[model samples]
Target: MIRQATPADLQTLAQLHSQCFAESWSAQEFARLLAIPGTFALLADTDAGFVLVRVAADEAEILSVGVRPERRQQGLGRALMAAAAERAFGHGAQTLFLEVSANNAPARTLYGALGFAEAGRRKAYYNEGGRKADALTLKARLPLGKSA
Candidate 1:
């Protein structure tokens, strides 16, 4: 049951994000971002997952996405990404972009399958304690297709 999320879902979105990442974003942060033009969120039910995206000019960037650990491997992430891409395209975007931790193999695989390719990199962009991981910036054409 995927649906567009409103500010009313802020707390739930924060809770779900906390389950998927070591660092969680607060509801206040979500509220601030959502208030910005062209920023929106899509929620897959209350317990499954959600994705946040911002479109500007001809480009759209995925700010964040998360699936409950238990809900992973069940296609939730793929569905969320596909939906986000379509909506972005509908909103006059010609390109979709996202940054994923280089250490996150599963997310890289999922993004790759959705036609995203490595566009650039940010060294040591994700730091956890003393452990650091590069952020791989990925890009795909709007209305994404499966990679050949």
Candidate 2:
């Protein structure tokens, strides 16, 4: 089931992100965002595990999302994306945008399958320990009927 996230979920989200991303946001950052106007967060919970996400405005950029590493490729990511899209459209978003690591093939494929198109790229957007990673900017334009 998908539902709005509370501040209590931040710690688990932070830990999940640490396992998924080379660099992760602090719990404090997530807490701060949770209190911001126009920011939206959602989580999917099941017997297996959960996935969490935060988007900004109705036209949101996916701030972060992750499922338990042990549960990867079991479709939780897709579930989270679908939930975010629904929330975004319900809130009057015309388009959803996100920046995925250029090298993350699985995420790119998942986004592409869900109607997201590569709109642009940000070169060397993340630098960690002398290594750099570029970002692929993707967008999914929603039909007018889907918007509030």
**Winning candidate number (TM-score):** 1
Q: Work out the TM-score per prediction.
A: 0.95, 0.83
User: For model 2, how does the per-residue alpha-carbon lDDT over 28-110 read when each residue is reduced to its tens digit?
Assistant: 87778767776766766642233433445557677777777788888888888887777777777778888888877888888
Q: What lDDT does candidate 1 reach at residue 5?
A: 91
Q: In order, how many clashes per candidate?
A: 0, 0
Q: What is the lDDT of residue 110 in candidate 2?
A: 87
The per-residue C-alpha lDDT of model 1 at residue 135 equals 91
* Alpha-carbon shift of residue 72 in model 2 (angstroms): 0.8
User: What's model 2's overall lDDT?
Assistant: 0.72
**C-alpha lDDT of all candidate models, in order:** 0.91, 0.72
Please write out the lDDT profile of model 1 over residues 1-148, one tens digit for every residue. 7899987899998998899988999999899999999999999866599999999989999999999998889999999999999999999999999999999999999998889999999999999678999999999988898342
Q: Give residue 101's lDDT in candidate 2 (0 to 100).
A: 83
